[model samples]
Target chain A: MVIDQIHDLQQVYRKVVHSMSRPGSISNLNNITEKLEDDLPCNHAFFLCALTVLDAEVTFHVVASEEKKARLIEILSSYNMSRIAPVDEADFILLLQDAPEYQMNQALLECKTGNLHDPQQSATWIIESGLLSNISALSLSGPGINGTQQLQTGIQQDFWQRRNDKVKEYPLGIDLVFADFSSQIACIPRTTAVTITEVV
Target chain B: MIAKPHFAFFDEGSKKEIRRATLKAVAIPGYQVPFASREMPIARGWGTGGLQLTLSLIGRNDVLKVIDQGADESVNAVSIKKLVQHTTGVSVTEKTQEADIIQSRHRIPEKALKEDQILVLQVPNPEPLRKVDAREYMTKRMHAEDDYSGAWLLLFEQIMKFGRMSTGASHPVYVNGRYVMTPSPIPRFDNPKMHQSKGLILLGAGREKKIFAVPPYTSVESLAFDDYPFTVESFEGKACKLCGSTDVFLDEIIDPDTGERTHQCNDTSYCMEQLNSEEKVEVENSYV
Candidate 1:
C-alpha cells in the first residue's frame, strides 16, 4: 500500500515533533515506513522524515558512497523537489550506514551551525544506525527532560564525542535524528546534554 | 454546498514548510525561526498564527480546543474552532483535559496539561527585543551577542516609575538560560505555567512570520531584578462568583444597575465544569 502523502506525513511529522521535544524518547515510524516502496538505499524513516520536511525551499545532502549518495539524492530530490547541496550548505544531511569516521567528522565539521543571529539555519543530520536498542545507554539531561532520562542506542561513541564537541556553544549547533532499520527513531536536538553512561 | 477546503485549509507544501520551521523552533528551545506565513480566511492578528499551527498539526485522531482570553466560547475562539472543524472534521472540545491540541490566546488552561498534549499560543510579536530596538538587524545582533541590557532596562524603568515591575502581560522570560523570549501576551499569572511544563508549548506569530517553542520540562524564568523579584497577579481573597473558586484567575465584572463589582473565573469552561460537578454531588446527596 502506498502512503498518503498528506495523512501519513502528518502522522510522521507529529512523531518527529514528539521525539524532538522530549529528546531521549523514541517514536515508532513503522506504520508509515511499512507503506513505503522497497529498494530504497536509505532507511524508510529517514526518507519519510525528509519528505515531511523537505521541499523546493530547502536543500539536503546524503553521506554515502559516491554511487549510493547520487541515488539517494536523486530519489529525495525527485520525490520532494528539494535541491541537493554540499555538506556545509545543506539544511538536512543524511548519514548512511557504516559511514567512516573521516566522513562523519567532515560532515560534522562542515555542516552549518548558524551564527548567533539566526541559529535555526543549522543543519539537521539524520543518521542511519543498526538498531534503536539498549545495547548502550546514554544519560540525557536538559530542556524537555524532567530530571535525567536514559537513551539506549547502537550508535558508536565517537559520533557522540563529535556531536558533543560541535554543540559546546549554545544556540549555534546542529540537531540530530537517528533512525534504524526497525523503523524506530529518536532525536537529540542541540539543547540536550548527552553523556554516554554505558557502552556494551 | 461549498467545496471542502484542502485538508486543513493548507496545501501539502505549505504544511511541509510550517512543519520544518516548527521542528527548528523546537530544536532551538526559545529561538525564533522564520517561515513563510500563509494568509488564512481570517484576518491577521485574529488568532491566525495559532490556527495555522493547529491546522498543520491536527490529524483525524486528534481532539482540539480553542480559547480566547480564557473563554472557550469567545468570538475569536469560536471562529477558529469552526474553521478547523469544517476543514479537517476533527473533534472540537471545551474540556482542556480531553484535548490533544489546545490552541489558546491570552491564557493557559487553569488545569495542568499532560505530557501528550500540546499547547499552541498565538504570538503577535515573537521578538523580545522589538520594543527595545526598533531595527530588526540590530536586535538580531543583540541576541547573537547575548546583549540583553535593553530588556533589563525596560523592566528597570517600570520599577523606577511604578515601584514594581508593571508588565501586565507578555512578560519577557529567559528560556533554557540562553534566549530571552516573550511568553506571548498571557497574563503574568500564566507566565509561570510555561516553566517546567509537561506539555509541549509552541508559539506562532503569523504577522511576525516567526515560530518558537518551549519544550516540556524546559526552564522558563521571567526576567526580574535582585532587589525586586518576579510576582504573579495577586488574586488573594478573590474568588470566582460563579464557581466560588478562589485559586483560579478571575475576571472582574461591574454591575450596571447598582454599580457593584464582582469577580468570576476567566476560564468559562472551567467554571462551568465546577458548577456541574458541584450540582452532581448535591443531587447524589439528596438521593441518598
Candidate 2:
C-alpha cells in the first residue's frame, strides 16, 4: 500500500509541477486521499504538488490559522514531516486564498528576493485563488507575460500604494504562482514591472 | 503525484539557477547570491539546503561526504548519503581526507580540509540582519552599502542584558573579508575552521530560497567586540568513546534498554578508524 501510494504521488506530482511553472499550463491531480478533505481544493492540490517537492529540509510558511495549521500538521505528519515553520522561515508560502494586499505584500517582502548575481532567489507563493488577468489592474511584460499581460483585480489598496515603490526595486520582490484546484498557474517575476490602473 | 526525482533531485532549470548563483558567489568570493531554489527530496530543517548546493556543484568526479553532528551514522547524515550515492553514483567517504565535497548539517570534520575540498553547510536562517530588519528590501540595501549598525545594536543590547553575548550557535562570520555570512548551525567550535580554509565553503538555505559562498584562502571571523572578543568552545579532556580520540566532537547517546547515557564520538567513521588503528598497533607491539 505504501509503495502504491508513493507511486501515485510520483506520477501526479510531475504534471502538477509543470502546470505551476508554465503559465496557462493545466494539469489535474488525482490523489485526493482522506488526508486532503479539510483544506480548500486549491490548498489540497498545493500540499499534494508542493509538499511532494518540499518538506523537512526545505523550510515553508503556511499562512493559515491555528485550526488550519493543525490540519496541515496532521496531513504533513503522515508524510513523516514535523512542524510547519513560520511564514518568514518557510521557503514556500501557501495561502488558500488570494490575500488582501497588505498580507500579500507583507508575505512578499518577507521572502528572499535573491542577491545581485543570481536574481532568481525569490519566494514561491502558492496562492489558493486567482491571479486575475485584466488590462486595467496591473501591467506585466516579461518572459511569462505573453509580451504584456494585464492582471485585472481589485488589487488591495495598500498594495497599490507601494506598487511603484516595490516595482522600482525590481528583481528584488516576491514571485507569485497562483494555483486553482482545476490546475491553472500564473507567475510574476521580479524582472516584470507592474503598473496599476483602474478598469474602465 | 510528482514524478521521480530528477537525476540529482533537482530539475534542469533549478540546477541551472543554483549553478549560476554558485558561479556568481565564486566570482564575488563571500557574496550571497540568490537562486530559484527548488524543493529537493529531503525536508526543510534537515539538510535540504546543502543537498541542493551539492547537487548544483557535483559533477562526475566529485567524492561526496555528508555528516550531521559530525557522525556518519546519524539518521540525517545517513539519509543524505543515500540520496547522493543514489542520485550521482559517486564515491562517498566519511574520511575528511578522502572527500572532495563535504555537505554538513551542523559540524565540520576534526581533520583540516585541504585546498581542494569543499564544505557546504545547510543553513536554517541565512540573514544575520533579519532579526533587526524584518523587511528583506531594507536589509538588501543595508548589505549593499555594508551597513551593519543594526546588528551591533542588537549585540549591544545583548551585552546590556547578559553582560556578554550569549549566542552560542549559528554565530555570524564575515566571509572573505567582505560579505557577512552565516555558517549555519555550526557551534563556535567549528566557526574558526571557516577562516582562511584550504577548501571552498558554501552555504545554502533550501527553504529560504538563497545560496552563498566563501572562497578558499579567505578571512572568515566571528563578530566580536573588543571588550568581549570571540572565544572558541573546547571539550577539555573529553574524548570520543568510540574512537578514544580527544580531538573530535562528542555526542551524548542514551542507551535505549537502560536509561544510562554515555558520550561517544559524533564522527562515527573517524572513531571506528581510530579503534581499528589502535588495535593494529597493539598487535604489532605484541609481535615485536
Which segments of candidate 1 are over 4 A away from where they belong?
A: A134-136
The lDDT of each candidate is: 0.90, 0.64
In order, what DockQ does each candidate have? 0.90, 0.02
Off by over 4 Å in 2: A1-200, B1-6, B252-262
Query: Deviation in angstroms for B243 in model 1?
Result: 0.7
Work out how many backbone clashes candidate 2 has.
24
> Chain A alone, TM-score for each of the models?
0.95, 0.66
lDDT tens readout by residue for model 2, A1-200: 13223334443433432332222334555444334555343355566555454554455666655566556557665564535566665656776553344566676566655554334444556566544444456665532223455665333545545544644554345545555544434444334456655543
Error of 1 at A187 (Å): 0.2
Which candidate wins on DockQ? Answer: 1
Interface Cα RMSD in Å, per prediction: 0.7, 13.0
